[model samples]
Target: MPREIQKAYKNQTRSVDGKPGKKYWQNSVDYKINVKVFPETRIVEGSEIVNFINNSPDELSEIVIRLYYDVFKKGNKRDSRVNPKDIGEGVELKTIIVDGVNYDLANSDKIKRYGTNLTIRLREPLKSGQDLKIEFEWQQKVTLTLDRTGAKDDTSFFVGYWYPQVSVYDDIFGWDRLDYTLDTEFYNNLSNFDVNITVPDNFLVWATGTLENGEKVLPNNIYKKFLKAKESKEVIEVVNEKDLEGLKLKHNTWNFTAKEVTDFAFAMSDHYLWHAASVNVAGKDVLINSAFPKGKAEKHKKLTSIQQKVMKHFSEDVPGIPYPYPVFSTFIGLRYSGSGMEFPMMANNGGSGVPVTVHELFHMYFPMYVRINERRFAWMDEGWADFMENLVIHKFFNEDKSNSFYSRFKLVTQGTLGTIGDLPTVTSSQYTGDSYGYQAYSLPSLTYALLYQYLGEEKFFKCFNSYVKRWAKKSPTPYDFFNTFENVSGEDLSFFWEPWYFEMGYPDVGIKSFEEGKLIVEKVGYKPIPISIDVVYKNSKKSYSKIIDLSVWKNDNRTYAIPVPNHDQVESIVLNSDFPDFNETDNFFPPLKDSYEEKGVKSSIVGNYYVEDYNIELSIAKENEALVIYSNSWVWLNTILIPKDSVNFNTSDKTGVLKYLEDVSGRDEIELEYPKYNLKLKGIKK
Candidate 1:
């Protein structure tokens, strides 16, 4: 265990048995905010009243506030490039009142400012189990950069990270002072919010929580339909283009209230189509909504229905947990057409199709409900969401293997593993740079899916549901997750965890030999992966796949033998599956040369070929009077191939030999042999 985790145990904030310690506490703040938005000017002005409860045992001499929009401020450090048009003065503070004491803004001794964090020294030390009140007024120009929160156009905006809020004071990390670098996301406390947003009279708002006064702000007929859709299972067009055009402008304030949520966000648009539906999850009706521009209505018409199915599947099938929120909305006007960002009860979507919708909705369970700390361990949430999204796509949506999640997972895993920028799952997400997507999403998701396969559906979900239930509404470290699964499953999964989570390696297994009713498979890579083999029979001309679970490698055995039924009738054995493999060229047995021995070389062998086992590229051709072979792998360069006969070939040196093979695609292939080096490499003509 790391020293930090050991310290957390000694501090009594977390237990070693995968549960919260007796003295575990998380600080929270209740916010009352009033904000006004000007669409034409793209300005947002807000004032907030914060009631912070110090639930931790340590006295707080100082407090930290996160200003997320400071990434747009000129000269601030940023992880990635931002739109130049959005660069401006970040948040302008107008007034600050702490416990009714006025503070001077220009006094350097009272406050210190970092790139995106503000540290304020308190006048008096706040004792344990005490509380304080703070008030602030600020204004910021809404950015057009189309980040997680930004304006899609002059009249459409998805606003997040707009308010200056108190940072999380947790049991493990005291103050989450991580900068908002547009790289890592956020870590926040579950707090209560009562916000009143004042927008143009014609614009409509879709926010993070249930609208407390929807009847007062919305049209009378539309308000009735919104209420009716909450109880009905049918999808209703609550605010269509016609309703948006016909509504009279009267009230401008939209009131919203959300209790025990991580953060708040809202989207406003003058013209957008809204669809609504409801589904009963654990005896609670969850209102599902989708809003998009009229131009995207045709593409997003079935979004609410899809969300209904996802809600039901996620609640009843996978995690077996109830939906936590009463209302959920997806606003479809993000900058790009395929990006999506998740909040507590809302999503800023890019109007992509079903997969993005399902992927973003799955986040509601991981980081949102379970409160996974995205600033450090993003894979904890992103990996699970991607895994569940792919699982639902295959099981519920009936997508084919080509379009299935596993296909993409295999492709990406194979491409990324052992590459230059590849890192383990335990690495901090903010440091992974170009490989962040692979580390946070593909690799871990593949690991989870493989774990599911190894544990089977019943045992897998039993442990999975336990982890979710234990960490719901709380922050959990990676050790907490690792320990919970081990505790629930009653198994020490160090063998599985060490290689995939903490180590650097990829999975590569290949066919060694098949003889005497037994097949020997070799583990060429460091990571342990399940073996999937397909056996083709010559007599029956049929094939069946034999699956070996990942537990076969529990002992770190390099080779395993499988008893093949009717081995005498087996014509070819191939190591093939949806799982990732680094080198697939040698997966086919019987050495393509043996099958084509009866027929003479049908195609020319003068071309380049790749030998994956040696990581070598071989250029072979008839150079002058000798068949010269040039290799750029390992230590050797060139070798001479002399014709032994019309149909056979051998090198000038007696130790080297070669034979012809016909590829499945009718390309000419060869098996090059070096007896002195004990090397037999299969090379396909490219």
Candidate 2:
């Protein structure tokens, strides 16, 4: 554990309600951005003039603009403390050229340079429905961070946050005050963007929004060829002919326009090998473009398939809500900064493989279109993206892949849930101090998994669709999403979100004991919503499950002894064996000793049922006044005791024996004296 984690855990406190604190939805904002990219110079310059149409009933003063550049160039000293290359060539704010001229507003004084974020304060007090125009020319040489932008080697440029961009203004953080922590994600308002990019003629430009000057920007003859290709829906190749010498001298530029976009990014590459596929996403004829090097053509194809599947899933899952774009481009490149990132119609994904592509593609529906402020409520975007990605992967590749993502996600959620001190969900900024890998990506992904488990697949999907429809093209706070889901599902989700977000705690459950056709399970520590248990009986036989809701209890420790109606017909019980539970290390069954004692009776005991590692042992102990069997690890065990008079017990009536034991136990402690029995079990470390 990191020192920070240990400190947080040691100082952690509990809320009065024993639930995570409440997170209210902040005020929403909408924006329209127009940008232009110079691909050859690797520069993306744009302006976002926002109308502060405050939907909230409160009057607000000045707004703060977050340009992620401050995190890299704080104090203008060029700190080499963090990732050296992330500062890249080092970012510099050339000028705050508003409406083409330098405008120093009163709020501009607060424009302190942070690590990678440039905080520009608004000049005047803007009331609801008021508008402001601000522009700045900033450039980044592009370095590699966890997910934002930079170059992998010198061959590729992962261009994102590679420019001085606007920050988000919401009710929660007011202006998102946290520094650029690696684990935290982003949050921005929805806006329209029109970008005109000028790049080298040899380089192909892939960016957000629609190409405004595709024909005029390309070589005259090549432009004509492209036009013809668009009309004929065929691949148009531009041949290098001696007569086209003049065309080669001119630089080609691709201008794009996009509406209701949260952010803007673009990539330029001369080595790109491009392919386009026309597919119908939600009755809308859209083009899916894949851009990669020649060596990655096969990977691009796989990405296309994943995109197709995601689009299909989105279309079917969210009814009456179609994708609002003419094209969905999936760019695959080695320069990718992270697994994948979402733009308006285009998503830049790492060439890691199909999983990264699928995950990024799903982002188009959440923060990309839903327009949630990602910095404050990253879970809203990342969690939803992860959920959709898992769903699509499962639909295509089956449970194995889905299980892998799910298990990984669970670990993240469990880790975070177990660490954070009791803080209000609204004020609990997990992204603030956390690492980018955990805060920005993994934690949010886990939140989605827990939400899915709590709401089940049907209601959860409905709530998700409702969230998208209600917040599409508009800014929505964490509260807005929670309220929408809760209202639609008619389930109070405060209990679910409180512990998951505000207080970091994971489900650490173990099978306490199993005997007399009954199983007792106890939560060792942490309060997960409901314990999802999977009990397997015989080989190839389907498992039985039960969701143990613990929301009604305040204590962290609770035990439940459920009667097994068919104890005689049972084989073994596994807690959270389905991988739904976030923390599984502490999850096991039939305490080893109890399992071993029952092992000779045509029954098998399993230990570390959830995790691959760990060992199981069986032993005997004395209980009550009778001799009984026990498991070495009482974490998950089952004990069987025989009556003193039944020395010659009939083996023919195993069911009867279990039934009699159940009647005698009746959910209470069974007093028995027993001799010790030893059984050993082991497994390879995972």
TM-score of each: 0.86, 0.69
Model 2, position 28, has a per-residue lDDT of 42
* Model 1 pairs whose backbones collide: none
Tens-place lDDT digits, model 2, residues 1-686: 22432332243311122111232233443444444444445455554444444543345554455656555553444313566545543555555644344644334465555555555544455565555555555555555544445554444555676545555554333466555544455666666665555555666677777667765666676556545534333433332223233334254656677666767777766666555545565555566666766555554455555666566666765332566677677666545434676776777666736567667767777777777666556756776676666666665655444233344444233324444422333443453443334555566665666677667778888887777776666556565566677878887776676766666456566667788877776766554545656565765476676665555334444787777666766765556533334334334454433543453322221111221233443333343322333343431233333321322111110111221122232321122221111122322211
RMSD in Å for all candidates: 9.1, 12.4
Best by lDDT: 1
Model 1 Cα lDDT, one tens digit per residue, 1-686: 78878988999888877887777788888999999999999999999999999998889998898888887888999887778977887888888788998778778788788899988789998898899898999999788875567888779899999898999988777788889888877788889999999998889899988889988888888898999999989999988878877566459999999999999999998888888989998888999989999767788888999889888888888666778889889999776666799998898888646777888888888798888889999999999998988788777876344332344466446646676666888999878887788778888899998888888889999999988888889999999998888989998999999999998888888788887988889999888888877677886857767678989899989999988888888877666445676655455566444433433434366789887776777887654333556674431334444443434665432345787665547776778886533469888777
For residue 242, model 2's alpha carbon misses the true position, in angstroms, by 16
- lDDT (Cα atoms) of all candidates against the true structure: 0.81, 0.52
Worst 10 residues of 2 by lDDT: 650-659
TM match of model 1 to true structure: 0.86
